[model samples]
Target: MERIKLHIAYDGTNFAGYQVQHNQRTVQLVVERALSKMHRQEMKVYTSGRTDSGVHANDQVLHFNSPMTLDCSSWRNALQTLLPKDVKIMHVEKVDESFDARKSAKEKVYRYQIINQREYDVFKRLYEWHVIKPLSMERMRSAAKLIEGTHDFTAFSASKSNVKGDKKRTIKSIDIWEEGDGRIIFEVRGNGFLTHMVRIIVGTLVEIGLGKKDETCITQALETLNRQVLGLTAPSHGLCLWKVIY
Candidate 1:
């Protein structure tokens, strides 16, 4: 059997989440169902990580061992034919047996989008969070700076996270910028992220931008490792798994 790697992108609006559930439609379920059809048996697929419901992905990676000897292009074509329109296989290739989708990943980048305007656009409602109050971009940037570098992100993670190890993670960078059309973007690159960590960080930054919190809030949360010290968790729809660096 040869190990095959796939680069995937999907619109996460309709699915329950990326992982398979007993009664819910999911990205993993569809992909695995398509593969089972192609291979004439059940096929187990592995992914880099799971994204929550309504969280889109621009470059998600996965791998599976297949006994069929189809070439990369043929595998891509066959899989694309079986998968739904919302999920697209962007690239495919044969990979070394040592390669693991999750374990081999070096870093991940997540982006959160916000429509910071008085009026929200109907078409972009599913993809962007709408905030009516004016946000101070300067304040957000200042808070973001405090978030960069290594820290124990326990305060930012979800209270119900299944993570068993320590919550220390290295954040490579955090970039906050505004587009001319009143769109604000928060892009964070890190070695790894705990569940809901990015969303909480974005929420806290938004609170700082709105003058509800100050930049010292981040420092205090990190030092205290207290979840209650942070702001709300941003909605999952506005967050996307932007990229995975191998």
Candidate 2:
């Protein structure tokens, strides 16, 4: 058997999530179904990470083992014929059998985009969060730095996450940049992330950007692990799985 790695991208608007699930349509399910059709056997695929429903991916990585050997470039074309238009195989290649998409991944990067203006654009409705508030970009930058290192990020995670083991995670960087036309983007890179971590982080920083929360609020919220202190969790559609590092 040969292990194959696939570079995948999909619009997560219609699908449930990345992982395989019962009955519901998903990114992994569609890819695996297409592979099974081509290989003439059931194929199991593993992704670098999971994005919640309504989320999106720019270049998500997945790995699987298959006995069928085909040209890497042609593999994408073949799979595209079987998969939906929204879920396409950007690229594919053979990797060392030891490479597991999830386990071998070194880190991940995500981007949360918000369109801060008087009115939301209908075209980009599914891609960006619309915030109707005047924001202070300088204040948002100051709050972003507090999350640059390893910390017990209990305050920034989903209350319903139910993630077992350690809640501590190392955030390599969190940067906020302004784009013209009232758009602000939060680019975050981290070794790992908890469920809704990026959404909460974005929401909190937005509060700071609006001058609603001071620097002291971040430290106080972290110490108390209170979810109420942060702003509302932004919609999942605004978040995208930008890239996965191996």
Candidate 3:
């Protein structure tokens, strides 16, 4: 058997999530089904991380042990042909047996998009969050900078997240920028992320931009580890797993 790593990209609009579930369409289920058909056996695939429903991925990584001896290019082409239009295998390669898609990852980058405009565009509605009120980019940028560096991100995570081991995560950076057309992007890079962490951070920054909170709120939240102090969790559709660094 050979261990194969795949770089995948998908539009998560139709799937329940990246994980498999009974009677639910999911990205993992679809990818595994396509592989099983190509390899003529059930192929179990493991991913670096899971994306919730409506959360897209630009370059998610996954690995699986396969008995098939197809070359890397052949595997990519065959899998793409079998997969649906929304899910595509971007690259494939053989990796050392010891490499793991999840454990071997060193850092991950995520981006959340928001359109701060009077009216939302129909074409971009599915990809970005629409905010009616004008946002203060200066305040948001200030708040974003405060979230950088090592800190316990318990306040930024989902209340029911199953992360039992550690709440402390090292954030390498948090960048907020805006395009002239009112497209605002919040990008975050970190060693690891808690469930709903990026979305909550984005929402909290937006709240600061709208004058609902200030930069000091970030410090208080981190110090208290209080989930109730956080702003609303941004919608999943606005978030994307941009890259995974090994």
Candidate 4:
């Protein structure tokens, strides 16, 4: 059997999420169905991350084993033909049998975009959250800085998340920049993430940028380890899985 690794990118605007649902459409369901057609059997795949609904991915990785010995080019072409228009196969290659897409992942980068103007663009609605208010970039950056490095992110993640192991993870980097006239982007890289962590964090940062909170409040939020102390979860449509490094 040949174990192939797939690099996939998808626009998750219309799908439920990455994992397969009983009846609803999902990224994994589509990919696996495409692969299953070519293999004449089920082809279970493993992904580095299971992104939420309305989330987009620029570079997501997955792996599956196939008993068929189809050429890589044919395999990729066949899968592409079967997948929906919103999803695309970026690359397909064989990797070591022991290599796991999740465990071998080194880091993940995500970007949350906000439109900080009076009006929203129809085109960017799926990719950027529309916030019609002036935001202070300095305040947002300062608050973001406090969450860097290895620390318990219990305060920033969703209270419902039940992740095993330590919550301590390093924030390798975070870059906040004004993308354009009314757009601000927050790009964050981390070793791992808890469920809804990035969206919750982005929500808090937005509150900070809007002058509702200061840098010290970020520390206070962390110290309290209370979900209610932070901001609401941002819309999932504006979040994108930018990249994954293995």
**Highest-scoring model, lDDT:** 1
lDDT of 2 by residue, 1-246 (tens): 788889988999999988778999999899989999998999889888888988999999999888877888778789899999999788888999889998998989999999999999999999999999888888888888877898888888888897788988999999888888888889999999999999988988888888888766777767887877777787999999999998
lDDT string, candidate 4, 1-246, tens digits? 888989999998999999898998999999989988877888799999799989999989999988888887887898899999999999889987988999999999999989999999988788899999898998888888988888788877876687877877788888899977788999999999988989988998998888876667677877887777788799999999998998
TM-score of each: 0.98, 0.96, 0.97, 0.96
Against the true structure, candidate 1 reaches a TM-score of: 0.98
Q: Candidate 1: misplaced stretches above 4 Å?
A: none
Query: Candidate 2 clashing pairs?
Result: none
Q: What TM-score should be assigned to candidate 3?
A: 0.97
Error of 4 at 202 (Å): 0.8
Q: Give residue 202's error in model 1 in angstroms.
A: 0.4
**Poorest stretch of ten by lDDT in candidate 2:** 213-222
Q: Write the per-residue lDDT of candidate 1 for residues 45-103, one digit (tens) a residue.
A: 99999999999999999999999999999999999999999999999989999999999
Q: Candidate 3, after superposition: displacement of residue 185 in Å? A: 0.9
Q: In model 3, how large is the Cα lDDT of residue 245? A: 97
Cα RMSD of all models vs. native, in order, equals: 0.8, 1.3, 0.9, 1.2
Task: Quote the lDDT for 6 in model 2.
Answer: 92
